[model samples]
Target chain A: MNDRIYMDNCVTSAMAPEVLEAMKPYFGEEFWYPGSFVSTGEASSAAFEGFREVIADALNAAPQEITFTSGGTIANNIALKGLALAHSGEGRHIICSTVDYPDLLTHAAYFEKMGFEVTYLEPDELGFVSAQKLKDAIRDDTILFMSTMVNHVVGTIQPIGEYSQVLAAANHKIWFHVDAGQAFGKLHLDVKALGMDTLSVSAHKIHGPQGIGALYVKKGSRLGAYIHGIKRFEGVQPGGLSLAAMAGFAKAVEIVYKDLDGSIKQLRELSDYLLEQLESQIEYVELNGPRGEGRACHNINVSLDFIEGEAITIMLDMHKITVATGSACASQGLKPSYVLLAMGKNQVQAHGSMKFTLSRYNTKEQIDFTVAKLKEIAAILRERSPLYNAIKKKQEK
Target chain B: MQYSEKVLQHFMHPQNVGEMENPDATATEGSPACGDQVTMYLKVDKENLIIEDVSFLSYGCASNIATASIITEMAKGKSLEEAKKITWRDAMEALDGLPPVKAHCSVLAADTLQTAISNYEIAHGLKEVPDFSKETIIGELKKIIYPQVGEDIITLKMVKYVGFEEKTGEVLIDLNLMSFDQYRDNVAEEIREHLQKYPEVKDIKINFPS
Candidate 1:
């Protein structure tokens, strides 16, 4: 297959060369378990410490505050469920936005099933969950307030710090969890600045290997009460970590932070140019996330009426262009995105959703190719559709 | 995940997906609930008793679109009656296996073909046609009563299923209620009153669910 235009980077990015090189040594010559007490294994333990330091430095977290997990989903589950279970005696009420990733909500759902009262806050039209909305939704019994910074599907950055300030002022003693899977390498993150108790990140998302991720557990935060452990960084995770993937994670973060300015600038330019090009070819193609500030520079989800996103995606894949209809995790369900539904789009518009996420590897030429192919596919599908005819009829009348 | 080679083959090289300019029959199935609809066209040779061509246009997910394409290929050379008999299972098999959640897609494909055959019969003035009026009204009523569990209400023997007088709007319904719950009765009564608002419904009969 000719170099397929990879648009599903939000699902997983091509591993960065530097990160790959960093992982190679650990996979072969230095492949020793960090937990081993043997004299030669001391180097592995030191390498593990270096991995923790890199992640800690990136997030402005204490090295002791970071806990490695299998991936973002597990980190999210741990954050939500661990908090709910540990604090269930304190208060059983948890408030989270409906726009949060379903896997995150699934963890919260388990709590709901276990007899906790959950209030799923809905985001506003632009995928913004306002601080006032959080304030109003908070109950006296609410013990946790959770949200995702930069929703993975739409890539809209939430006002985490603003919302956290309100929770801080109320002195509500609520544990705050921020699922920063999409935001990890793409944007700045500081655990203290956000006032969040727990934050999640995945390795593959930042051009590292899959099955390795980390969580930021702010020191003295309420979340620590829930996820307690004596071994391996205080027991947030009980098992010995994958030292090899961790090696990749550390290198990936190092590269991102080192080239953060240039990478983010390229992502923004590609995203802006792609949107501009798409707007020229398609009618009523509304950008689904934040139109200006508060949007992640790497993602652009759009809803184009008269075209089913799945059809466009298949046709694009045929042209060797890879993209996604929605979040890959829930794409198979065929339901209009719950995130978009919570953001106030009706079923038809929500079903016709497509997400274009840029990585450091994406370029302007690739974006141009994608837009042209998408235009052709969308136009062809629309021409064959009777619903498109009805829509056109309504527009004309 | 990598799909089986059969899936990728059908997906990558879909057989038929366009309109028939002069179709022997046309069918359109509308899924108002999910709002994903499909219209299919077929060219059948009556003397030969085989489909000469098949095509479809779908406004749905990838699985739905792919099912339509696969159905068109599968029905291309079959007789009208044989084509109409294409089950959701057969369509799914042609594509190896669709994700189970999307098995309903194959049903949509079959329904679209049935609708096109019905259209062809109407246009050609087939003398003896199945009376679709009663089933159509009942299907519409079921759509309102049991939005999520439409299939369940269909199986229940509680309502007095009736075919109404076309012009007078009078229904000959027999209702059976096995349970005496007020909530259940209220739902039944609401459906009854809503149907009465239609000009063609004049009278109804009730037999308590036994």
Candidate 2:
């Protein structure tokens, strides 16, 4: 009936037209790889350096510190494994939270299998892992710690500054790595200010093209090579990366960093409006994450009582809207969202949770239409819900 | 895995979906904790032993709702004996096919319908309440789908052995699932939920291949 309304920007976003325009030339005649002497190669090398500078500038790091990777997952692998391999001789203990992103958790599992001990810090009910907990979990043999800057599921922004302070107080060096795939453009990140030894960010999360991301390894940190294939450019991740995609990533970074404050403000307003509308229009809706500034600007997660999230997601899809749900039925593994469960939410709450991640493209009108359609869907589904009927009967009694 | 066009049609616009007032017989299957629960209501023609009307209320995913809707449609005009023959496979065939992971929804819908029919027959003095025993435990196990293959564990031979200690109300099951099987946890959780409803099963221990 209408153009597809995409609200799942946290997974991937619509590439900006400007980024495509910037990438076109690289895909065409300027596609030469970086070289030592050839004119075309030198020019390509200079352009590559310039693109790296754009991303480094956003993070207040040098161009040489940035290593381009295929995506956030690869970047995470390189930084995390590199840190582990380089420092495992020093200590075989790692620390992370139970509610961290899957990338970090999987890496933790791998480390555990490699004869390293891992301590998972528990998060508060609102999904915040306190720095005090991190300090307490630290041991004499703890050598590394990894955290997700902005939680992908609930959008809880962890206390990175306090975490860095705690790690600094440790007697032994504890390398800190951050998975900032969801935080890159949404928040102002200064690698030096955050005191993270290594960090990862993806281009697609900020209106850039997919299949391109960057890893920031703070200067003076020795990371063992994770990917060893070729000597194409100097970086931990070896092999040739797409010049066109890097150009697009640079363009996307420039656009967002150009007015980062303004973009964040707009997203916050849109999400606030959406949450407000849902609360006012719907009955028995509960917010899953923290309210106000503690949560990310783009994410709004809420649980609708008496209705399963998969049904709601499909009904909204029929209305030409796209969103995410935490229901076990929607998952390939047939398990509820681990993030919500880790936050002490019951299975029903997790099953009914709906996630709406806004972007620069969303508007007030779109939010209005979505909330209205969602209200109708909730009412329709509730009419056919035994849970709701049972409640009504109980109240009648 | 995607739903068939028929399944989507039924899910988007399910038939006979509502709360039935003054139903002759009713049964609810599954649980809210499992993320799916279905309640079925039936009005039977006592003289003719035919199902005069049928309705259902579902709290679950699209497939769960669609299966319940189609099961009600299939049972509406059938005799009690005829309705008793309707299995989850019939519902799956009626809806073209369902994803393997969602095949359990059909089982839940069919199970609810059969239970409603049993309730009616018992109330009408046509049959006695079945005794809960080892056979009853095995019958419930037959309803637990493997999810990955869209087949029950009993049919797939995943159930290595089933033991019941009637005096202690303890049930033991040895499964052939490997320790690394992705569906290992799902199948075990399903078994517990299915058997926990029976008063005879006070405890369950599921053994997997280490």
- Report how far residue A164 has shifted in candidate 2, in Å: 0.3
TM-score of chain A of 2: 0.99
Residue B186 accuracy (lDDT) in model 2: 93
Work out the TM-score per prediction. Answer: 0.81, 0.98
True contacts kept of each: 0.46, 0.89
Residue ranges of candidate 1 with Cα displaced over 4 Å:
A34-38, A222-236, A327-330, A391-397, B1-26, B32-35, B41-55, B62-83, B89-101, B120-210
Shift in Å, residue A165, candidate 1: 1.1
Q: Candidate 2 lDDT, tens digit per residue, A1-397?
A: 2498999999999999999999999999998988778899899989998999999999999888999999999999999999999999999999999999999999999999999999999998899999999999999999999999999998999999999999999998999999999999888899989999999999999999999999999989988888889878874267888999999999999999999999999999999999999999999999998998889999999999998999999999999999999999999889999999999999989999999999999999999999999999999899989999999899999
Query: Candidate 2: which docking quality band?
Result: high
lDDT, model 2, position B176: 97
- Superposed on all Cα atoms, the candidates' RMSDs to the truth, in angstroms, are 6.7, 1.2
For candidate 1, give the lDDT of residue A371: 86
Candidate 1 lDDT over A180-222, as tens digits, reads: 9899888778888888989989999889999988888877765
Task: Please identify model 2 stretches exceeding 4 Å from their true place.
Answer: none
At residue B16, give the lDDT of candidate 1.
79
